[model samples]
Target chain A: MVNRCLITPARTLLTQTINPSLRNGFPAMTEARVLVLDADPLPRLDRLGARARVLHTDEKSLAERLPEADVLLVWDFTSDAVREAWPGPGGRPVWVHTASAGVDRLLFPELLESDAVLTNARGVFDQPIAEYVAGLVLAMAKDFRGSWELQRQHRWQHRETFKVHGSRAVVVGSGPIGRRIGLLLGAMGVRVDLVGRRERTGDPDFGRVHATGALPDLLPEASWVVCAAPLTPETHGMFDARAFALMRPEAHFINIGRGQHVVEDDVVEALQERRIAGAALDVFAQEPLQDSSRLWDAPNLMISPHMSGDTFGWRDDLAEQFLDNFDRWYAGEPLFNVVDKKLGYVPDH
Target chain B: MVNRCLITPARTLLTQTINPSLRNGFPAMTEARVLVLDADPLPRLDRLGARARVLHTDEKSLAERLPEADVLLVWDFTSDAVREAWPGPGGRPVWVHTASAGVDRLLFPELLESDAVLTNARGVFDQPIAEYVAGLVLAMAKDFRGSWELQRQHRWQHRETFKVHGSRAVVVGSGPIGRRIGLLLGAMGVRVDLVGRRERTGDPDFGRVHATGALPDLLPEASWVVCAAPLTPETHGMFDARAFALMRPEAHFINIGRGQHVVEDDVVEALQERRIAGAALDVFAQEPLQDSSRLWDAPNLMISPHMSGDTFGWRDDLAEQFLDNFDRWYAGEPLFNVVDKKLGYVPDH
Candidate 1:
């Protein structure tokens, strides 16, 4: 059954009235009132003013206005309002979408139990993350960091570096991001072992797609080990002392996955002891890692502040995806990218 | 008919009398007296004892010893012995293989006219060069350089980066090295445009292949422009002022090819003007690039001492390749990776 709900059109009316001066060829959205909970105001909403009412609010004001909205667009991922206000009086907004993957911050007991639809920005990050992983693999293999340091000192020391082709790699995660990483490395004649929840036949040239249980055997043979897995009960702290111990002393470890999946202290120890060659870490268990953290002093380590998938024009892509999803919903078609309450994706697992 | 040559039993007797240690497994001209003219000794050849006598000589000794050797293995790439002495020899060796790629130093008129076969260490570098190109592409796109700087300053700034997938790239050169680079990037979902010497049918991924003439059109559209072309009359200084101007302002240029292909001053001007985003250079017109060079101060530039295709087991692989070629030669079978004298490869073309 399709959920139909009425929305108060004040915000939509205000947005429509303000749009013409801002954008050229602005499109009108005339179906429902859309409440945007974003830290910064979106100027593109002016284009959708005629068909839809757009209201802007922060976390504090969201709960009071929850009942009147027909849809909730979570643009401010840092806010927890979506979780707190989702179980409001008029049976929650018919649909809710976050402009980010991993809806951990927006999940609440009440929202999880509701019939409201949830979707995420999944496809947008696949390529960027894959590219990041490839870069790290190359950087470590070529010793770009060492070369850069040498250049600064005006040193002309020529040293040999490792090669990516004909090397073995293990990409841990079967989602879009991990699959893309595997595909990129595989194209380069690298033997890639992809680890997923379960083996699937449709995957591309993956040497062996094993379950998480096979990681112990796979780690020792890999020349480059990458963690692109999600942060879940089974995945958290998965790359601990034991995993690092299993890897070849010359192997490089990279993490585009959540920080908790790797124990930071264990990684520090491994790098200090040269158990593993080096690592490129984008995410951390804590955001804005404290300046005093010992990871800064670890040899051969690269730290990026959790920005692997972000790219120019990303927001525009997210908005376009949602608009396309909205059109599909209005036409009585099954919504694409529906998040299953249990699996946190569409078609309910 | 294929050229046929034979080694007499007397010559083999001379090798056995001078050096018996080379009889076991020394691959390169085991039954020949060899001369190494480099300042540093070839430690790699230490195992090739009695059957192959290695004489470390200066210009004077090299001039005196030129008449007796069965082969000349040029480990000192900077020396001009082959160019000066080949014509003066009583019985010059039948073969000469340089440890370096460019034959300009040894390609004297006398050697060119002689029956002496010449080869370069070509296969050993193909994968490593490809890997280096991949690293530069990833590093530029991910802003890895900027992130490293931020880390040094103890700042955690999250910035956006571009994805490699669905992005367009142009790899100039169709040799084993360039082809491998294309394959690696293609695996990452990038639509790679490969520019070769000339366009042909029945080639791998024929649809994406382009000729050198297409550079003007291809440059602007390429998000990442990789220069892997060999140094030739046409390729020398190919990526100069006009080439830099044609690129998209956001595009990144990487040179794994000869440094002569790029005009250093023009590159500096382009970088200074921000007409092109950045570049990573592993080669230069003058290596051990002058310490006073202005390129050091150029914004968004990465420099390395031309060690892209070098790795730890590289010499071992070269030895293995030579042995395989030796087996083919001894068995009167067609040799693999034969260099065409005119095209600098065995007439596979």
Candidate 2:
């Protein structure tokens, strides 16, 4: 049955003549095995053709199957099974790719030190996530929640809402997603202060990209503070009590990066105490956030499932992106969106 | 007692020399009596100085005071008392300035037939209403109402949302308010078709402005259809059953122009039958929509109490705008935003 599912394409001759992997002692392209960490609604890998052997495994079987594959496709990106199964494997794949922008789940010490090249779906989520963040900013400013509640009561209460233009924003992270967010907000007439890992001056769009260290000064002045940084050791819990405390009472915070990037308790406290105007979290420390979580009922809070970048047909986008990278891998070409394992993200030049 | 509130400034000396109304059989600028139709939290007219006598009147007293005033300030722009009392007992004011963008209420036959020059609060609400409309567009596209419902239930249901960047919009009304809406939506990467009374091509921002007659063709292609046209005889009830039928099933409608621009029953029917995806109405066929209205229960409908343009400090912005025009009126120079009675709006050049 497995043999019938695999293709015997005419490209076998092409692989032998031009493929550089043969010179590196790697298996012939046709013999390369790809193990996809299976999740519900599996990826469409029909484009792989007969160039590679494909296998599927759940968390329970991943470790046992790791040694048999030349490449690992982390299709269930939300699972941390790879971190646990990496060490138990007899030998790891030469390449590991995740269907997500963040490489945090695969950032275990062993993987970071391994010879495997890690790649991510970095560009896929940038525009969609940026749009989601902008929507949250506008939602909070316009008090749509209040309007919705009033609509339910069939009341005609007229209230003045805030204006989005002329507002100030502090976008934490200089990546494509964060920069895109900055650009969208700037287009809406917002004054955007982009904060990255280090200070960068003379940016054509933002004029000056402030370093993470400048966040303290930027926080108090910003009406909208967004977190889109990678979940590195330096960024984990970056928006803790101290960071939330520095924000103005009327400031709003939006988190679309990773759950660990925020200390959930601090956000709940801020909302409970009305220290901040409001907060919107598309991610949580432990998601599916427990039903008993206090964040659920936090005042002036908006909680959405981790779907900021999941626009219609996004799965297809991810699958197509992976196929393009697969084509490059089959041709012995360097993969796009290769993450710097130490940084846990694809660093911008 | 009213004289105590009036300013007896040196401007009275300057008024006689430059005021052109004096030559037109109108009252001298300094002798002008201003009647303000009052509402709660009345306007600050301290800037009017000592040049004119300012009198405040409610609906009951408006008719009695109409003949005594040479200028009328429609401070309570929502009142229709002007329509009912216009032909009652006295001559109308030489000039009427409404603190609102829409002059639908002041467009009564008597006012339109009279020589009274009408001006509106045009530019004040342009940016704010545009932002409000943009927010509604984003809110609908992102399914924020769904998120809020899920959040209330503490459910984590991940769903794909629609993208806004590539969407199309049809913005009715080519006046400043409509143009501003088109520009802002255009900046957000939406393809906007600005519809006016006549077809206009080669517009710098919008290459072509479709005539109102083209709405049938445009509605089917638009994901967002906005109504910002003046509520003239030709425009009243324009968004009727036939118009709603032309819209795509996934298209959303937003009305911020005037309540009468839409036929309430048609909108309710469109939402009830699910003919349209959704709608947001800042202005309804009636203000302070009654608690018993059927529109309150319409599906996929968002209703606000006509506060789209009333952003924070908006009243102050209105007052300041009127004062600038009042300065022009006092100097006998042409006033900004002077309405064309025949068109029922400030005609664009």
Compared with the true structure, what per-residue lDDT tens digits does model 2 show for residues B1-349? 0001112222332243335444554434355677899987788889888767789999999988887776789999989899877854236677788998889899888898876778888888888888888889888999999999999998999999988888999999998889899998888889999999999899998999999899888999999999999888889999989999999999999999888889988999999998999999888776789878888889999998898887899988888877887776666566677787778888774
* Every model: iRMSD: 1.2, 0.8
Candidate 2 Cα deviation (angstroms), residue A54? 1.9
Candidate 1 local Cα displacement, residue B56, angstroms? 4.6
Candidate 2 root-mean-square deviation in Å: 6.0
DockQ of each model against the real complex? 0.68, 0.73
- Could you give candidate 1's per-residue lDDT for residues A118-235 as a string of tens digits? 7777777777887888888888888888888887887888898887778999999877788788887877767889997766555445645799888888999999999987666678
TM-score of chain B of 2: 0.91
Which lDDT tens digits does candidate 2 get at residues A1-349? Answer: 0001112221332243335455544334356678999887899888887777789999999988987777899999999999888843336677788999888899998888876778888888887888888888887888888989999999889999888899999999898889999999988899999999889899988889999999889899999999999999999999999999999999999999999999999999988888899999999889899999998999999999999999998888988988887776676555678887767778774
